[model samples]
Target: MQLKNKKVLVTGAEGFIGSHLVERLVELGAEVTAFTLYNSFNSWGWLDTLDEKYKKHMEVFTGDARDENSVRKAVEDKDIVFHLAALIAIPYSYYAPASYVDTNVKGTLNVLQACRDFMIEKMIHTSTSEVYGTAKYVPIDEEHPLQGQSPYSASKIAADMMAESYYRSFKTPVAIMRPFNTYGPRQSARAVIPTIISQILSGAKEIQLGSLLPTRDFNYVKDTVEGFIQVAENDKTIGTIMNIGTGKEISIGHLTEKIIGLIGRDVKISCQEERLRPEKSEVNRLCACNKKVSEITNWKPKYTLDEGLKETIDWIEKNIHYFKSDIYNV
Candidate 1:
């Protein structure tokens, strides 16, 4: 299960976490293929920002993951496949639930089928903390009941189940990696961390946010990527779902204040109705129990919340031009 000299295909390799994983895989000496959403402009999303040295060890394949043919082509001849491609924005999912199903669920089906056909060694399917919805208990474990409160969470639930079924029915080597709130460089402004950092960096005296009460277990991008690799390299992880997180929780309001302190700014918080999720759809709290991943792999979060936020703030400050801080990014 060693990754060295192995062939790995990462769907959504152009994304924040995916790009970082690709860089890590290259560093591990794995032959990497980056499956990005197709675009006329040939943009590789955040992958374009990777150093050319890392890009030399990787192949970029532009294709829609929902397309079975495209997915098959990308999965072909690969030893392992990490399925990360999906429509992940929760707010956008409310506006277009059908698109979320098509991209998240069906896109995952395409990957699963291709893996079954190709007989891939391992398939690391990405899941989210959103599927757990509001925690019924503190420090939620893998045994926690799943409650899909949003269209995005529902779609991901479907995708995770589909991956599990593949492992059971077809004996596909699949490991579901559910990461709790990962944040770092190249993360979209739609995510809370980026939203807060971008706004503060943009010199906003007032920060617009939704619910401040909801608590989340945030993991740094590098740690999450390592979790993915560790899960994939461990044969014991097959047919199991593992949670990757810091196992610490933070309320959005408190998290905002921390970011403001890091930026050394005095800002007032404004509750924006448009940014709020529907009452039932909002997940009130999430805290991860990393017992499964810790037992299965040599993976644990290295960066503390303050440490990660500092890195994110530094990156956002230098890349403020990429964000429209005044607008609420859906």
Candidate 2:
């Protein structure tokens, strides 16, 4: 289970959390292969921003996760596989549910089949809190019933079920890592934290947002990546689903005010109709019970909400040019 010198392949390595995980794995002396979506620009996504020292430790593979041949090639000879590739935007999923099923569901099936054929040491499949929809109970546990309120959530629910079935039917060494609202420096502007930070940094007097009443348990990206590594390293986590979160919740309205205070700005909140999810699709509350992960692995959130928000604000302030704060990012 020791990662040092282990051959690790991370799907979606170009993404926010995946990039951080790749960097951390390299720092731990793991032989890393970064599998990113193929682009004519040959872009590595967020991984392109990594310094040369870290990049040198990584082998970049450009391919689509939806392609079984590409996924199989990437999984071959890897000691462990971290499956993170997916179409994650909620709004976009609404626009193209079929694409979500193709990328999220079928893409995951590609990885599972590859792992099964190659007999990889382990596979860490990514899951989202969105699959739980609006919480029916406070501090939702792993056993809480999943309610797919949106196409995005439904796609993820299908993907998670596929991973679970692989573990049960084929005895695949797959562990599902479900993270709740992870946000940090490299996160896309589609996410609320980045949306708020970019607007405030862009000197906007009014911040446009969706429903402010919905609550979420946010975890820092670094903490979430740590959970991925810890869950993979622990044999007890095999064939299990672990929730990585802070066991805390905050309303979007309050969260926006907190971010405004951190940015040292006074901004009016404007609820944009286009920004809002459909009434039933909107998840009203989410709070994770980290008991499973805490008991199974020595993992806990290392950053407080305020501390994480401040760090995100600092990063966005420096990288303000990357964001188009005037436009609502779908």
Model 2 regions lying over 4 Å from their true place = none
Q: Write the per-residue lDDT of candidate 1 for residues 127-164, one digit (tens) a residue.
A: 99999999999799999999999999999999999999
Q: Determine which window of 10 residues in candidate 1 has minimal summed lDDT.
A: 295-304
lDDT of 2 at 102: 97
Cα lDDT listed for each candidate: 0.94, 0.95
Residues 195-275 of candidate 2 have per-residue lDDT tens digits of: 999998898999999999999999999999999889988999999999999999999999999998887888899999999
Separately for all candidates shown, the number of backbone clashes (residues 3 or more apart, or on different chains) is 0, 0
